[model samples]
Target: MLYRLDISNILFLDIETVPEKEAFNALSEEKQLLWEQKTKYARKDEFTPAEFYERAGIWAEFGKIVCISVGYLTYTGENRNFRVTTFYGEEDKLLKEFKQLLETHFNQPKHLLCGHNAKEFDFPYIARRMVIHGIQLPYKLDLFGKKPWEIPHLDTMELWKFGDYKHYTSLKLMANVLGIPSPKDDMEGSMVRQVYYEEGDIDRIITYCELDVVTTAQVFLRLRGDALLPHDAIKKV
Candidate 1:
């Protein structure tokens, strides 16, 4: 079934996020108390709420997406090319741009959204943030009534799991085992907050996010027993 699906119908994507505020004290006092309650168990006797604040980006309510990079395949006869684009800058602004792309181009029932570990992270985070910003949920992101098999979404990590619920794999590890280039060569995910907030180097982060999108598409092709994309085949738009 995987081989039968058209690669062009899939929109491979990745997102980079950071805490909503620059520091714990930047949040409202009420929100700070809520944050403590929210992470109480996870940081129990280990790290204070202020200390654990670095990971707040993992939760949509506490974080904001800084970038969303998407890639899709185009075919001219047998020649295939992957074009990548990024919607970035202000959170609400970027989310609106990303929503436009989905509604304008990838709204078909046959279209799919793919990312590494997207089911657990990227997909839901985007949806939640969209709602928070009062942006209408796009059809592909709105899964309120769809049955499990009816959702137009794909997770490379879930596919690799092969029903092993106990198993977990990082994108770097999966790319390594599958012989795809590692996207983390430039910087680690943990540094995104610092890079964005401190260094104010969103261009660097954008490049990193785009690389992950390309690598994810490559992983999908490899999983389908197809040829990996050549370096020249990936073009940033």
Candidate 2:
């Protein structure tokens, strides 16, 4: 059962992304046409490609990761602590560092990657961005030959679904219902592009991303019927 799994073996993470370019006109003509075609149906006639560009961070092909925040638990005797750290700045550099982290420390078969809605978004986005940058995929992110049961990944949203594929849950909503602290008190995902591009607030985005990791970890703990982590026990490493 999930409750029986070791907390220290799971790496909980979240990522913040923004469009590759600050403005739609900044893209090359070829890419502009491609983006138009790619988002044609989604934008319909209601909004032009430029108008829809703000939401481009949802797609890895058009977006770039700005921050990746990860959290993990460690236990010493009966005491436990949750530590978090963030990788930011140049996309390629942060991605390589994150890869090194997985390959070096969390590469064991028993290690699992967990996040809220990560299976559908964060996990694949990182893998796709890594491939676009020509970086070799770590075993945890590379899922080519792994069977369904063999994939060492977990999603709290999927767990909440309880085999109901039709349901969708946001991390904030999940935390609200579970009595976990809200991660969106300061800002929401939709504002990330504005914060990063216009405001030049990388630190704010990193804080938001790290809060998400902590909230996801808390959601997992609540799911496993464990005690909520005290605020003092969470350290930023």
Candidate 3:
């Protein structure tokens, strides 16, 4: 008999960022000028700390991860099912809970963590933020010290099309190209920060995050040639 680790051991997540209020206030006049010269279109000079927080989409505001959506799917016998953990709280508290979940369920590296753009963005963002919150990170999210191109990373975008190495490819377009239904229309990533700031609504973000996780699972299973049952693995979130 053979045993296989389940996808429930994996946590699929995406992060949104916005500018930090303190960091925005601390920007020196000289640095501000240089930043303006760099991000030419950015009105960094004109933005008050409040304005910066209001406008930051994926870096400073929602970038701070006011919401973190977690999804897990695993095979049991001949069936696959998923559970979602939707969290809306301070980033530090959320990171602690997220890390704890990974640490508890995944005591070994055999249980791989999977996310769409995790290697380049999601994983690093979560790991660093965890560190900032003084939480110990799990092995799955600890890739900061690993050499580039050598770490165990499975990005859906890279794995797809054998990695064309293009400048940019959003998850929306990737899903579309692969004939998968994208969740972008639910609410654009750009609107995340605003919704979080104004309405304090995380439902949209959770929907968005869980959908990506499901789609990524599809891409992964497809790339593995449907080694898992097609119906079991392809459920829409």
The per-prediction tally of clashing pairs is: 0, 0, 12
Off by over 4 Å in 3: 1-9, 22-57, 60-63, 144-152, 161-163, 183-185, 227-237
Model 2 segments more than 4 A misplaced: none
Kindly indicate the candidate among 2 and 3 with the higher lDDT. Answer: 2
- C-alpha root-mean-square deviation, each candidate: 0.9, 0.9, 5.1
Q: Write the per-residue lDDT of candidate 3 for residues 1-237, one digit (tens) a residue.
A: 012424455565666654443344456676555444544456556765445444543433124666566666766686777655666577788777777777787556556666677767777777767776677877777766778643544566666546467646667777677666554446776776656656667777667666766667656655555543343454443
Q: Give me the runs in candidate 1 sitting further than 4 Å from their true place.
A: none
Residues 1-237, candidate 2, lDDT per residue (tens digit)?
Answer: 988899899999999999999999999999989999999999999999999999999999999999999999999898899999999999999999999999999999999999999999999999999999999999999999999999989999999999898999998889899998664458889999999999999998999899999999999999999999999899999
Deviation (Å) of 87 in candidate 3: 3.0
Top model by lDDT, which number? 2
What is the C-alpha local distance difference test score of candidate 1? 0.94
Look at candidate 1 and give me any clashing residue pairs.
none
Query: How well does candidate 1 score on lDDT at residue 46?
Result: 93
lDDT of model 1, residue 228: 94
